[model samples]
Target: MSKIYVLDTNVLLQDPHSIFSFEDNEVVIPAVVLEEVDSKKRYMDEIGRNARHVSKLIDRLRETGRLHERIPLENGGVLRIELNHRSFHQLQEIFVEKTNDNRILAVAKNLSLEEQTKENGRAVILVSKDTLVRVKADALGLQAEDFLSDRVVEVDHIYTGELTLYLNTDLLNRFYEKGELSLSELANHPFYPNQFIVMKDALGTSSSAIGIVDHIGKKVKKLVFNHDHIWGIRPRNAQQSMAFELLLRDDIPLVTLIGKAGTGKTLLALAAGLLQTEDLGKFKKLLVARPIVPVGKDLGYLPGEKQEKLRPWMQPIFDNLEYLFNTKKPGELDAILAGMGSIEVEALTYIRGRSIPEQYIIIDEAQNLTKHEVKTILTRVGDRSKIVLMGDPEQIDHPYLDEYNNGLTYVLEKFKDQKIAGHIKLVKGERSGLAQLAADIL
Candidate 1:
């Protein structure tokens, strides 16, 4: 049976092509949605960029027919602008504030009633990215759904980067004897590429052998890069060990790290980058950049150069660099930074036009970015460049982002199965006991 999906403004802002996501279903766009998009199009951020993209898509669709009238789509569905929905009259009774949310609810409620009496008896659903809007729909006895096209992974089913599989002692013996074993000898199991493996005896007789398998689970490889310390830092967990392996692997150009505050996401990546570029001589330079999204109010119009204005937002990066350099005196780190012309710390604002090659790029606070911004960064990777994106989805400062829809999650979802990328989620907080307890209990 066909369904009618009414899109809310947040849905489009979250994903510009959300209109086409309901591919074969009839999509309804309330006039209020356009108004909201228009209001956001002038901002100089990801939301504004997506709003403009949505407007362009809608404008292109106008060539087929007027947006106010239902038009046939190539997918045998319809796109419509619901200007005559009757729920506006009913909403005035309860919500007299004339807010955007109230207007959207009114349209949704009226559409649900209209679709019930249609010739084909289609079901009407209000599709929103907002939790409160869905609650309002449920209160009105209407079917509602969250815009789920952006979700990275199913709840409770996220990637763990570790796998345990049972193998006979003989097989383990052969693996140890031969220094390698084919994946065909192992039993079938769901294993992601470069996933760390703990091969247990299954009889509980001895310590389990730890190893890593290729994405296809074909070849088991031992962890050989046993550095006592990475640039004077140590791996906090097994997941970080796996992340370090992935980061050092030249074949894999992409790496992602996720964790809450104080989990050492930025510290680990920066240390690895420093080791790779300055110590290992793999890359030519160490480049670090992150988006500018203040936690609270925006700091408008500072009188300074680019780096000075960005100093407040990029101080966290500087703090990590200072620790990695191990400088004792004040301004000692600045003296080192001045000498290392190869190291560049800039904002994402100026990264669009240049092509970076032979560099170790670290993008911190990636959760504040959008899917488009992330793409722009990735697309700028020239040959022999390794890029690491690290951020906590829970700490996003972008207004339109959440745990499920941030760019970091989006990259993890999109490129997880590929061989060139690796991801890890750091669960335990290593900053302090109180911080970890708060992360768990509060």
Candidate 2:
């Protein structure tokens, strides 16, 4: 049955392409939503970017036919703008004000009443990324939903880059003897390119082997860096071992690490970055950057210029570097940074419009970015440059992003099949026993 999906301003701001996601269902955009979009169109953030894109899309749609009247969409659907002639009269007094949200709710309520009594008995759903808006919509007797087009996969089901294979003792023996196994050896299990595996004796023997699926998915080869250390920091767990392999490989230019707190995601990347830039000279520079997203209501404002202001925000990176440098006294790490002259730390805000070549770039807290933002950052990489994106998708600071829809998850899912990119999800925490317990229960 066809349904009427009312678009909310947050939905459009979260994703400009959400209008086309409802398939053949009729989409209704509340007039107040456009007003809200207009108000935010001039800002210089992700929301503003999406708002402007939505405006352009609306302008293009206007060429086809009048948007006020019903217009045909390419996906066998119709779209139209809605305005309640009754306006605030139908709104509840409890709502108090005729705010944009209430106005949009009123439009949705008006449509809900109209669609219920239609000859075809269609359904009306309010689509918004705002939790309060969705809740308010429900109170007003309208079905509400979150815009989910960007959520390519569920968080729990995400590809973790490593999987355990319970092979028969004979297969394990064959693998150990031959040093490789064909893809057909495990007929029931399939794997992605570069996916790591822990082959265990299915018969409960202590025998096990660790290997990685080749780029062509033809065979599994033993890990080359199983016992190697990167800048004196070794992998503490199997997942971290997998992460180090991906980070150290020069072939895989793009790598993503997803894990909970204390999983050593950023530490492994930084260690590898240091190894490649300082020791191997594989890259000309080591650049580390992260988005300046605040955890709570922001401190409002901070003093000092960009580099100075970034100190607190980049302190986590600094902490890892200090640990690697084994520095005790103050200014010691500063002296090292000054002496190296090849390490650069900056905010993601300034990374645009710049070509970064022959550099080992690490983008921390990638879960706070959008798919478009990641694409922009990746395009800036020049020849011989490698980018490592590390983040715990479950701990995103961006209000509009979640584990499944953030840029980290997006890239990890989209590039799973590509040979040039590799991903791993670290489950075990290595920070401290207390930290791991708190991460699980808290």
Error of 2 at 143 (Å): 1.7
Tens digits of per-residue lDDT, candidate 2, 148-217, equal 7879794468888988889999889888998899978776677889998899999898999888899998
Residue 135, model 1: lDDT of 89
Residue 339 of candidate 1: its Cα lDDT? Answer: 94
Residue by residue across 24-126, what tens digits does model 1's lDDT show? 8899998899999999999887778889999998899999998888888877788998787635687777667778888888888887777678777788899
Candidate 1: regions farther than 4 A off: 116-121, 215-217
Model 1 TM: 0.92
- lDDT score for residue 59 of model 2: 93
**Which parts of model 2 have CA positions greater than 4 angstroms off?**
none
Span of ten consecutive residues with least summed lDDT in model 1: 153-162
Error of 1 at 134 (Å): 1.8
User: In candidate 2, how many Å is residue 342 off?
Assistant: 1.2
